[model samples]
Target: MSNWSIDAGVICFSGVLDRFTVPDLWASLSSWKPTEKGYLVDLSRVERVDSAGMVMLIHLLEHAKTENCHIMLSFVPKDLGTLFRLSNVDKLLAKHIQN
Candidate 1:
């Protein structure tokens, strides 16, 4: 299972973020709205991620766009970054990635 929390305006995620966990995480974030200055998504504690997790992150970015907000991803895992590159979405998500 995966878990996420918003603390100090940052969304922190932990545990595996695979197909099984993305759904619940997505549902839990339905009501989330980024602040005017945007939001930071911290994934440092996330142990694993798969395609589904990538899709969910993309969807979250899309959702933020609709609200005229920006979402920045931070502390991305190496595997997840590799997946993004392999999926050819690195460019699309590049602006949102933060070191």
Candidate 2:
């Protein structure tokens, strides 16, 4: 199962990220209004991810870009990092990645 929360303007995600959980997450984030200088997406607690989850992240990145919102990805897991690198999205998401 996957869960998400917005705390102090940061979007926090926990649990496995798979096809079943991607849509709801997308919906929730799509409706978000940025009150801070930038938006932060925290994925450290996310235990797993499938292809669908990766696609969802890419789409979310595009959405944020179109909205002119600066969104950063923080605490990304090693596995996800490898996936992104292999898919060639790491460079595109480079500026947004935070260790």
lDDT of 1 by residue, 10-80 (tens): 88999999999988899977778776668899999999999999989999889989889888999999999
State the local distance difference test value for candidate 1: 0.90
- Which pairs clash (backbone N, Cα, C closer than 3 Å) in model 1? none
Best by lDDT: 1
Provide the clash count, candidate 1: 0
Q: For each candidate, what TM-score against the reference?
A: 0.93, 0.87
Which one wins on TM-score? Answer: 1
The candidate 1 region of ten consecutive residues with least summed lDDT is 28-37
Q: CA lDDT, every prediction?
A: 0.90, 0.83
